[model samples]
Target chain A: MVSSPATARSFARQEGGAGLRDSVWGARELLVALVARNLRMRYQRSALGFLWVLLNPVLTTLIMVGVFRYVLHIPVDQYWGFLISGYFAWIFIVHSVTESAGTIREHSYMARTLAFPADVLVISTLMSRILEFVLEIILVASLLAVFRHGGVPAAFALLPLAVALLVGMALALAYPIAAASVFFKDVEFALPVGFTLLGYLSPVFYPLALVPEAWRDLYSLNPMVGLLGIFHAILYDGRVPPFSLFAISAVEVTILLVIGRQLFRWKRSLFAEIV
Target chain B: MSSDVPRIECVGVTKRFYHYEHRTTTLQEFVFRQLAGKPLHVRTPTFHLEGFDLTVRTGESVALVGANGSGKSTALRLIAGIYPPTTGSIVTRGRLVAVIELGTTFQPELTGIENVELYAAALGMRRREVQASLSSILDFAGVDEFAEVPLKYYSSGMRSRLAFSIALGSDPEILLLDEVLAVGDVSFRAKCYDRLAAYAANGGTMVVVSHDMDSLPMLCTRAVWLEGGRSRLDGSVDAVVQAYLQSVTSSS
Candidate 1:
């Protein structure tokens, strides 16, 4: 059916928030394609293919478990369980942020030629990482059920909320970082160091209790501190996180998302020219 | 909704590209500049288009003809909404598909058919639509035999033919072509011309950028000759092409 010229004009004249929504909503298929492209490219030539998605986190967890449990001997019961519950969540953030940082530059060709929302590139990167994270979580949950003597905990039901919160946080950071990377090539190079620092700073392998009492307040200030705390509570302790912790993280994620989204939108138009 | 309303309207459009002389593309350099009280980067604006105006009514097939750096491609890019005009406004009615750089969006590692799906999706074709057109797209590209082969294994001509096919598969209301006919063998080029002529005959609006002057009259009824960053002439394809050729030969 032919659309009225007035309807076409409205589509052409859309701007600011409304335009952004339209672009994203209209390009939903493109988003799915981009996510599929990323996943396909990642596993395209590899011998193991999809196995790496499952094996990667499991292997990393084992190495961390061996070091912290056997070599370093950090005292924590069901250490592997404790490690993976929080470790998987941390890896999700790390992978998403690191990959998102370079997403715009890597897909510069599409950005330059195609008229889709640039945000889709960053969002799809996060989506693909989220898919992998979901797979990793399934692996972690099943392992916890078998080894912990108690089948998957009741709090496992809250895993989706936890995943949602983590995804929000990842997206919140990713938007600005991806935009910044387009302007400054440093973002791509600097992200590894940042993630490395963030990994050690957040309680991925060790418990928060292990940190000296004096540093706890400052360390808790890290958004991941509260986020990982929830992951550990649900998957490690088989209990709900404190209401205060969940509330604070939610508020923080929302605020960061607004800021990141604004920064991305402001910088997005310049991308085709700059990249 | 009225037929009187032009399908495309560009009034006083201008685009400027900043060519950086000394740019800081790293945080380290940026921070050091801040500490040293120096500007982060120095750039000069180069106008690619200045007060460029165009209007295309329904069923009008327009060709932009120009020399290198004459901004014909930039004009098409602006019209395609790939780049926002630095000044003025552009209003385009209907779905637009631009075949600017063929196969640029295709992944070399992906199979020919996979790339076709990816490209079609990028052009904003729905999954069902893409699936419906899959066989026809492959058939037109003449890459059906190597549909399962990775794009890297296909020749450059095959890759572009497939790209062209996918872009057309969207069945866009407005089609923007940038020298796409330059690719593929003679038979394929003829097939493309036939398909495009059919598209125009069916009332599809088209804006094409091509250096192939001979093909312009066959494809477009009207032409705009751009000089520097502005439209120098707009008239029948024959008139504009004749003027542009005379200018080139006189200059040479």
Candidate 2:
């Protein structure tokens, strides 16, 4: 049986210039189907099901607000609102990196069998997290609107812009760690520890202002700071942040993404072997 | 091109695989490994292909016969562009699909239908196009009743049938089969071979690597015998098969 010329053409076009065009493009449909399967399997046996998407973030945000605002007496209104916004964003990065580190290793069977680009696994894993992140964004935005204190701001229009920046940052952080975990098994152990340190050091728990003034500049080098700062500004402050902050964030995000992709490619061949 | 150029070609290709220790019991050994400038016990990498050369023309069904670890699979992988050669190069001009580990490509958690779509998509079919052919593909795989079930639940025969169906369903210009005939029941294998015959009749090129010398005369126009990653004989399937079988029987 001959595949239609139209199907072949469309496949070639999607591949564009990559050497893996045929394999990668061919796997595209399968990628979507597989992802849908993963999504379904994830929700299938659980009693709570999809509700957990909303419930998990809401529960975590409540805990953070209760501890920081109620116990610490931070005196902030709509504190759950603020905590929810930042926590959801932080979770996106944490969850993506935590799970994706061993993506190739976990899928060793599929990797050896199918001829699709190995990067498709990375892309698929990222996509599942992204879908979940979108759900979190919607839930957090709805909660903020319903609560009505520190209500939705005009600057919220920039939320998409902030989300784009964070996604780039997350992908940047994930690539090298994912690649290294294939050969350097120690990276798997170190990843959780690194995420824990990054959790406290970044603005996930406390506002950046809490840090001593002299050390704040040094800390901003943590790209999460730039990402979280921008997200918090949009939700809590209701204003577009200063241009300098956005500019610095844009530069840092670009560098990390480029380097990450390079490292991932560099170690690509070893995946089938080591994994 | 006057059929001068080989449809499949490999020039002096070499591949090596390093073996790593299963587990190091102590941190001292781990540290000492790097400091010692060597492994405590290093297993030399096995060479799958070494300085191998071969050529097959258009419209030819080439059966590659070799014993276990004889570089048959490695050569096929190289031809399919799955792994680059450590030395030399592999050059080809058409789409190639290797039916190596069949349904293993399907994620176990996903349903059979989902796997068909995913595998088809990876081969470069668009979502809608794949959807249009979805029912037909399932019908051909003959597992329509179990289409909705997850792949992990499928029997080995069912998996083999489905994988072969999907691989052939795509209609690639070049097909590489790695001992897939050994899978499934006898009737299913017969059906697969019949389908493959039709595929070859349609001018599709095929390269099959198998230990079944009896089947070579029926399937292949010409065959190549590989030993230690080198071609030991090349001729009509019957002659090459006879030579290989004779060599093995006399040696034993």
For candidate 2, give the DockQ.
Answer: 0.27
Of the true interface contacts, each candidate retains a share of 0.42, 0.19
Per-residue lDDT tens digits for candidate 2, residues A14-129, read 11212343454556655676566557766764658778867777677768788998799765566676677688899899888777767888888766755567767776777778
**Candidate 1, overall lDDT?**
0.85
Q: Candidate 1 — which pairs collide?
A: A5-B1
**CAPRI category for model 2:** acceptable
Q: Per-residue CA lDDT of candidate 1, range B163-234, in tens?
A: 998988789878899888797999999999999999999888899999999999999999999988999999
Best by TM-score: 1
- lDDT over C-alpha atoms for residue B140 of model 2: 75
Residue range A1-275, candidate 1, lDDT tens digits: 21121222222342221122247877888888888888887776676878877776667777878999999999999898899889888888888988887888999999888888898998998998887789888877887878883776788898999999999999999999999999897887788899899889999879999999999999998999999999999888888788898899999999999999999987787788789
**Measured against the native two-chain assembly using Cα atoms, what DockQ does each of the candidate structures obtain, in the order listed?**
0.43, 0.27
**Candidate 2: tens digits of C-alpha lDDT, residues B103-185:** 77677777888788777766655677678878877877789999999888998888888888888887676788988878688
Regions of model 2 farther than 4 Å from truth: A1-31, A44-47, A74-77, A146-151, B1-5, B20-43
TM-score, chain A, candidate 2: 0.85
User: What would the TM-scores of all predictions be?
Assistant: 0.94, 0.89
